[model samples]
Target: MISGNRSKAWRIISWVIASVLILPIFIMLGSGLSATTELFSHLWDTVLPTYVLNTLSLALIVAILSSLFGVTCAALITQTNIKAKNTLRWLLMLPLAMPAYLVAYLYTDLFDYAGPVQRFLRTTFNWNSPNDYWFFDIRTLFGAGVVISLVLFPYIYMLTRTAFEQQDQNLHRASRLLGLTTFQSFYKVGLPLARPAIVIAISLVLMETLADFATVQYFAVNTLTTAVYDTWLGYGDLSTANALASLLMLMVFLVVLFEQKARMNQRHQSNRPITSSHEIILTLPQQILASVFCWSLVILGFLLPLGLLVLMAIEYASLEQIDELVSTGFNSIELAVYTATIATIIALVLVLYKRLHKDKLKALPINVSGFGYAIPGTVLAMAMLATFGPLDNYINDLAANVGIEEPGLILSGTIFAIVFAFVVRFSAIANGTISGGVEQISASIDLAPPSLGVGRLKGILTVHIPLLKSSIFIAWLLVFVEAMKELPAVLLLRPFNFDTLSTQIYQLISDERLEQGAIGAILIVAFGLIPIIWLNRNEDKA
Candidate 1:
């Protein structure tokens, strides 16, 4: 690698950009710390304990359920001779595209007393009054846990399945020679090997369960996410909201740190010798049971909710609704475009610099940007307001002192804050995608360029960009999809009277009018599929 004035320029620019992106978090921390103890005392006396307990319980319950469902399904598919596993393999991942909040709404409507299940139960049982029979309520914390777990179990399933598939068969042969049975081998040998993957997957589930807002909010569970929204938007108390956001960020950061540490120390090196895997031949009873169990999750998590949404759309579709949906769709796409483009550009620059630059601190920019991914969107939105509100005030004061017109809320009162917050939250996606692509590019390309007297900048422009075209497109599409579905961040950061598809759908959810916005919800779910499908296709090609 060659270093010169050009390298120095990029080094400075990289640090500046990374620092600017991370500045909001520091501002939020300052705001939270500046709050008087009176605010803390009030929150502690009223709702803080409830928020923490609900959040912890939700994460714990979801993690346990997801692990159980995912490990069983993965074992059925990978460790046993199950029927229709090829179909099951891809079907298992379909739930990833379904949002948890949508699942909550659909299932609530399906299982409530006013819904078909309960009504049918009451009618069939000849129950005239409430004491006649027992029925489960779908609006409680337990219900929220079940709905979120259904869609999230796929993370564990996918990772554990891959680990099970790739486990060295030699280990199983030794276990069998030592008189261990099939189930015994799985428990003693295979399960231990897949533990790291399972831990990582569970950590992901915990992070997502913590990030969820609409689902818990709809159920009135009072997690930190809803607390932030209620404190700021409902009560107009920014200081307490910032403090709660800071605590949430702290929790997410701890999870991220654990995952990173475990990942670094993981012992499953791919360099190990490959061996064929053994699939257990199942009896008829086992086969039937496994098939029923796996498909039940698929149907409940994806097919049922999706089918319900479609039915609602068909029954309620109208021109007036379509017109409003189109307008909201445009707003979502516009926000996605802005956020994706900026995030992708920053990711590309930072990733390329790390790969090409000859500096000990080349990793700093990427390390900084990746931290944002673990943060929940509501926290990020609070961070944005905390940072930009003061910046806007400073600019307005300066303008007045200089006898120029005051620019009120130019930064905080517009879509700029929303887009910027989204970029900060999602920049890690683009960074990871492009970084993987950059690694695939041969080092010889850079070596050959300098020998031909090509400057580094020209070589990057002419050579690197061309090679990274596919990755750039993929990164941009992922960020776009994420921004479109993002709820809490846009809901908090969007200007007055401005609505994206997410915020509008949330409004419909708040008012119990989801049927009217079913078409838009479908659109959001459909948009979410692009990145997942694309990632699968890329994985297939590789």
Candidate 2:
């Protein structure tokens, strides 16, 4: 009876947490749908069409460019006999650690007319005026797409490379036995098989491109993300911002649905691991070209941008900047700690309930909780405001009725809102990681505990907790890193005078003074790299 009561309590708690996480999203969507048509009409007549168009165009361009860069690089690394394959393989993933906005700012500074590249060009040819040579502008829509793809293509490259490496080798051998050459075999058999991974990768790129605000904002390219930010903060129109955020959320939902549909019928699994003999041998010229191609991605994506930041830090380091960095770094660490701890705990609860519970709806909480991952940070921020703004008002009203001192925006305007948003936004990461870990333990282990006279809660604490230590640590670290780097949600939800490393760097970038914040930017990048390095190490061990 006690075990049954405990299980029931766990289920109730899991559902309550899931509902709380999901409420903000539903409120935001409903609020937008129920918004006054006049606001919609005004937006439609003014800048709405342009924002929607620019958003769609950017997503398309990013998808195409990332597909080209990622698929080609993955192919070269997996299929061809590229020199330094091992080094290039992990180096390609390093770009994932570089944020898109930083790359945009660095590249623009480097290639702008007044910068060294154009100055070198003019000096080389003795050209005096702007009309002497036409330089490709790095501040245009296409340029934003390129800059974003530089950092994001690694998502595609990493997955697609794994797919290629895991493809059934027997199929390739059969193709070789037929009239197919190495390239032909890859095209006909390998590429077709890896289509699911490529599709999923591109979908991730699209979601990220849609979520992007700082890059497009810096480039003066209007998108829904920037529109939502402007509508809320620039104009102080929460209703209008909710409407815009809802629209963006709809786009992300479509992408998620499309990704699901694309993979619903696909099943590509293989027992055979790719071997050395199956690697395509390239001629000397082909070898150089492939090596150059792979190395160029690493250089342009991560190494060059990182080198620029290092140079800036060396040139512009100052005592005042270090003082400011210390303050903002503390804020970032504190915020990340709160977000990671809460998110990991929630993940543990939902995953464990699903694992041990006998209810038919056992999976519902975890499924609903993960939906936040697809919601962009801008949209999630709007959702938090929509949900919490009124709650804070109600609490204040109740406090006044009871003759208590009123709390001022405690939920909406304080760190509570920011931490809640972070947990909602990143719960999926923790869920997926912890769930994967939990799945590794045997089902019989649960029985063993009960058979040994251990209660469910005690068994979980002593047995499951110890076994999940590694997974729990990883889940916590991943969420911590993401929270430290997350900008949009925190930017919208932070209290007055509050700043984290990402926000501080974004402000410096906005004011064209990133040099002063170079050390902070490097710190953010270093945090971003922790998970990538961990992932690479695990892959090597596997």
Candidate 3:
């Protein structure tokens, strides 16, 4: 009876936690239903169709490009003797430090008509104006797709590289002995074996592509995310925006379901490491081609835009503005730290509970909590507003019923709401990182403490927590970088005067203050690059 009571108590606690996490979703659905049809009609006529088409095109382009770059680089570095394989591996993966939108901003700032590249071309060729040369339009769907691919490809690259690196060396040797060429070995053995990782990475890249707003908006390439913003704010149509968001959500849901089915259907046919021995020396022509490809990708993805940002920052530097930049930099670091701290704590608790209990009830909260990543920042912001709006009203009403004066303590328009939104949106990064760590641990280790008569909680702390130190650190860094770059959620949910680096950049860009925005955008990218470099270091050591 006492044991039954304890289990029931835990069940109730799980329910409460689950409800808190899922409350925003429920509120959004409820509020969306009540919004009028007039809003829907307005959106149907303007921006909706273009948004869907452009979004689909952008997503498709990014997926194809990211897959090509990721899979090719993985094969080159892992299966063959690519020159400077270690250097190429890190260079390929480092683009993860650059966000798609920031890339779009930086590229446009450098290559657009008034930017340096075009100006230099005009002066060199003695061309009179914009029409003289067929310079690429950096504000089109093509431009946005290219920029998105530059940063997003790293997702596929990192995953596929890991998959390739972990493959058995024996398989390659046997394939070669059987008279198979290196290319055939890769396709027949290496590629098939790494399919699962490639698919998962592609799905992630697709999800992020769908969720992106910054790149699409800046380039004026209308996508569903930008449409959600346009429908809600531009047309004053909440219902239509919600309906559109629901559609976007459904698309992600279908993709996720497909991924789950694919995972179940997958079979492990190989269990050996592909590159257990050192890489074989490539022929001179092959080596040259490999070097060229690696350098070109690295230059395009990392060096070029970063160099431009540095130049611009130097051009604008003055003793007075240095103090302002320093202050904003501190604020950015502080925001990133707090958001990472909160996200890691929540993710750690959820992971621990799920691992210890391994029950459907406990798993539900964490799973749904991670779904915040799939939802766009605009949709999440609306969900937050819908949740807090009524809660505040209810609190005030209750206070009135009790004849109390104030009830504004509810977190409606405060920094707490912004932080809460950040936690909800970013929990996926932390959860995935922690969960990946936990999965590496052997099952026998989990059973150790329980068999020895230690309670589940103590076992988790003493056994699981100790085993997951590296994962916890990675989770913190991932969440910190993501939070630092977060824009739309911060934009809508921030307090009356709050300004994080992301929000500050957005404000400057919106106001056509490109130089100032460039500075903030650069800082955001630099902070993001730190973790990517660390990850690369770890990969090299492995």
Candidate 4:
């Protein structure tokens, strides 16, 4: 009877936690869906159509470009005998650690007409003005897509490469035996098998493209994310902003559905373990082309931007900048610590409930909690404000009635909002990591704990906690790193006079003076690298 009551209590608590996490989103969506027709018409007549077009166009372009880059790179690394395959494989993933907006700012500074590259061209060609030669502008929509794809293609590359690596070697051998060339075998067998992974990857890229704000904003490309930002802060139109956010949220939900479907189909694909490695040997000329392509991606995507930041830091390092970095870095770290702790704890509770409880809807809480990962930061920020803003007002009113000093916007106007947003945005990471860890424990151990007269909570505390220590630490670290690098949500929800490394660097980029914030940018990139390096090391070990 005690165990039944405890299970019931846990089930209720898990559902409550899930509901609370998702409550803001539902509230925001409700406000938008029920918004006045006048506001909807106003948006539609003015900039809404343009924002929608730009958002879709950017998503489409980035999807295509990322697919091309990722698929080609994965194919070369997995299907062909690419020189330095091991080195190139990990290096390709490093670009993901470099944020798209930072790359955009750095590359623009390099290739703009007044920058060194153009100046060098003019000096060498003896050209004076615009009539000398046409130059490609890095600030255009297409350029934004390319910049985003540079960092995001790694998602595709990693997943597709794994799919290719795990494909049944027998299929490839049969294709080759049927008089097919290496390329034909790859196209006929390998590509089709990896299609589900490619689709899932592209869906992820599309969701990310839709979520991007700083890159599009810096490039003066008005997408839904920027539109939502401008509507909320720039124009103070909360209702309209909520409406726009809801629209963007709807789009993301579609992509999530598509990705889920692809993931389901993915299970039908061949997962036959590799018995032997069969690599297509490249001709000398082919080797040269492949090497150049892979190396160029690495150089352009990660090495160049990182090198520029390093040079900027060396040239512009100062005590004043360091002081500011330390201050903002503390803010970022504090926020990340809070978010990581809360998210990990919540993930632990929900995942454990799902695992140990006998409830019919055991998985519902975990599933609901993870929905926030699909949400863009901008939308999540809007959701936070929409839900917490009114709640804060009520709290203040109650405090005043009780003759207490009214806490001014404690929830909505303080770090609480930012931390909540981060937790909501990143709980999925913790859930996934913890769930993976939980899955590794033996089922017999679950019975053993109960058979040994250990209560559920005590058993988990003593046994499962020790076993999952590494996963818990990793989950905390991943959330911490993501919170540090997150810009859009923090930018929207941060209290006045508060800043993080990402926000500080964004400010400098906006002012066209990122040199002053190069250290902060470097710090953000370094934090972003923690998970990538950890993942790569684990994969290598595996």
Candidate 5:
């Protein structure tokens, strides 16, 4: 495949791009590991411990609760004769589109003491004092956990549901022959098979929980993500912030390790046909309970918050808000376009290199470049500053030496930085999508292209690109939506007076006035639903 000069150049270009993508991460780690002794001592003496403890606690609680929600819902939908099972399956996944932070803000409005719920209760009981009743504090760490679980549990539900569906029916049959009740047979034979997938899914939940910033920050529940953001933007200490980011990365590293270990330990493959499986028959009461549980998850996770946003938007909508949404919506769309295009191009380059390059070792660039998906935006923001800050200085010095005006923060404080960060963070989505499409194309097609006198780039444009058009579109759509909803990195990296939909919503949230941005919030939510709709369609086809 690497028979000519052009192929060799492609391989070189692929490696260079991969290096650039990972360069920020390496710089962040260097900054963290090379921190001043005083900074280390001060951090170790204060704040760091609290951040670590909060992060660990939040991750554990979210993971456990999300697992419970995911497992129970998966079992009910796939293994029982539950009411509305078909609708419940897709409804459960809608929450994944609702960003946890948005849910947090909306729920806080609904459940806050001054919100309608409390006002109604107070009027109903004719009691106006705090002692009149008790309400759960929606701003507490536990509250943050539950809000996160609502959005994140679907990760576990989707994966575990697939795992449950793929289990060998003969195992269930054997258990039934042993006189086990339907429920008992599933409990003993089914769950054990799904355990590894469940563990891996929970690990994904924990990783996302650890990476969360806007949700915990709004709730005043400080985790490592919020800490890193605060340390940089609040304290104006880049080194300390990078150190915290490094620490967060360590936690994520452990999660990745755990996921890998679970994957390696997986032993649940079965030869049985998935369609041959039996769904357990639920009693009337059990069916009712199951229906209520699944429906509640959908309501709280996606529908209720969405309805509230729509109401707020309707009640408070104005020409000014519409104008602002237009401006920020354009910003968001422009940013997502730039990010998706560049990341997709990078993904295509690297993936094609792996497939066509003679040296198998060239494939390493794909993994290296895609690593940023595992990184939190807050961490990536710190890394970007750590990397680009120095580069900006060098560029300024060079410009001054050449008798030209210094361009302050040309790379670090411009839209370029924001686009670069988005590409780094979301390239994995593009890579995975493109790789799937590329894998589906038979090797014989590559030979056909060459037999037709098509060279490397020509072959890609004529044969591969045509075949991959759908995948490229899907990849672009995924990255675009993710870039639109991404908050922390843009919150840090956006230039003065710049606001995308997410950053604008976060601003209103921080000011305790999400209603002002309700239109913007709903717009973001609507964009998030595009991917979910696509997934539902694909699942139906499957």
Candidate 6:
């Protein structure tokens, strides 16, 4: 009876936590319907069709490109005896450190009509102005999608490479004996078995693309996420913004449903132990080509922008602006550390709570919490406002009722609001990484502890956590990098006069002070790159 009661209490706590986790989404949906019906009509007439087509087209293109690049790189590094394969593997993932908006901004600075590339051409060939040549605009949809894919491919590459390393070698030998070429063997034998890894990576990229507000906006792309911002801030139409956001939610919903369906068809059995019988020794030409491919991605995604920033930092070395930048750097670092730590703690609790009870009630909350990672930051900020505006009033009402009212807590306009929004937005990263780790640990461990008469909490701490130490570290690092690069949510939600590196960069770029913005942008990327390097070192162990 005591054991049953303990389980029951834990179960109730899980449901309560789950409800709080999902409250933002439900609040957004509720507020959306209560807004104007004309907003819905406007969506159907003007923006909905274009938003749907653009978002879908971008997603499909990014998915294909990222998968090809990621899977091929993983195969080359893991299966083939390529020169510098170990170094190349980590270099491939370095692009994750470069934020999409920063990439777009730098490319624009490098290649735009008024920029150095065109200026050099004009001075060299005795050409005049903009009309002398037709330059490719980096502001187009195709360009934006390409830029996004370049940085985002690392997600697929890292996960799929690990999957390839862990794959069962017998499957490959069996396929080869049955008559398959090297490439064909990869598709038939390797790809199918790595489905789980591919699915997770692709889903993450899709969600990131959908959630991106800065990159799309900078490029003037009319994605649903961008529309969410334009409608709310540009037109001051909250109802229309919410309506557009609801449609965006539906798109996310469909994607989630498709994933569930696909997962249902998976064959979960004992994986054959992975081993390799044959390895390819690449020719010199092939080696050069691989080197170029790897370096090009690193340069385009990370190095060039960083170089520009270093130059700008030198240019601005004399001013107090450098000191100000350093101060803002502190704010950004502190916020990122706090956000990552809190998010990891919450994700651990949610994942463990769901795992221990094995009840639908607890599972629902964990799943709901995960949804926040998918929502666009702009939409999330707006949802926070809508939800909290009335909430603050209610708090004040209670304060008045208690006869101790001075001024109600202004949570929305304070640091508390920014941190809370960050947690809500980024909890998914921690949850996903930690949950993936939990799944890898054998369920038998949990049953073992109970059978041995250990307390449930003690079992998790002693057995489950020790096993997940590496994954927990990786998860925290991933969350830290993401939080550092985050801009849209921080921009919309931060308190007055409170600035981070992201906010500073965005402000400078928006004011057309490209040189100044490049400095802060570079700092953000540098911080992000630290984790990429760390993860690469840890990848073999993982």
Q: Pairs clashing in candidate 3?
A: 167-272, 167-273, 167-274, 168-272, 168-273, 168-274, 169-273
What does candidate 3 score on TM? 0.90
Task: Give stretches of model 3 more than 4 Å off.
Answer: 1-7, 169-179, 271-282, 319-323, 326-331, 358-362, 400-403, 406-410, 439-467, 517-519
lDDT of 2 by residue, 1-542 (tens): 12442467788899999999999999998778777778778889999999999999999999998999999999998887789988988999999889899999999999998989999999999999899989999999999999999999999999899888878788888898998998899999989989988999899899989988899999999999999999888878888889999999999999999899778857855555554447788999999988888898899999999999999999999999999999999999999999999999999999988888887898999999999989899999999999999999999999999999998799999999999989998999999999999999988777777778888888889988899999999999999999999999988999999999999999999999989999999999999999999988998999
Whole-model Cα lDDT per candidate?
0.88, 0.91, 0.77, 0.91, 0.89, 0.78
TM-score of each: 0.97, 0.97, 0.90, 0.98, 0.97, 0.88
Error of 3 at 425 (Å): 2.0
Q: Write model 4 residue lDDT over 299-407, tens digit each, in one string.
A: 9889999999999999999999999999999999999999999999999999988888888888999999999999999999999988999899999999999999998
Candidate 6, residues 342-455, lDDT tens digits: the string is: 888888887887676656566776777777777777777777767776788888888888998646548776766667777887888898899999889776666877677777
lDDT of 2 at 446: 75
lDDT of 5 by residue, 1-542 (tens): 42342466777898899999999999999998876768767877987788789889999889989998999999998888898888888999999888898999888888898889889999999987989788779898889999999999999999999998888788889889999988898899889888899999998898789889999998998888988888787878898889889999999989988998999988745654544677788888888888888999999999999999999999999999999899999999999999999999999998888887776687799999988988898999888899998999999999999999999999999989889999999999999999999999998877776777767678889888999999999999999999999988899999998999998898898898898899889888888899989999999999
Task: Report the poorest 10 consecutive residues by lDDT, candidate 6.
Answer: 1-10
Greater lDDT among 2 and 5 belongs to 2
What is the C-alpha local distance difference test score of candidate 6? 0.78
Q: Candidate 5 has which clashing residue pairs, if any?
A: none
Candidates, ranked, lDDT:
4, 2, 5, 1, 6, 3
State the local distance difference test value for candidate 1.
0.88
Model 3: lDDT of residue 329: 68
Cand. 4 TM to true fold: 0.98
Question: lDDT, candidate 4, residue 253?
Answer: 96
* Global fold similarity of model 2 (TM-score): 0.97
Better of 4 and 5 by lDDT: 4
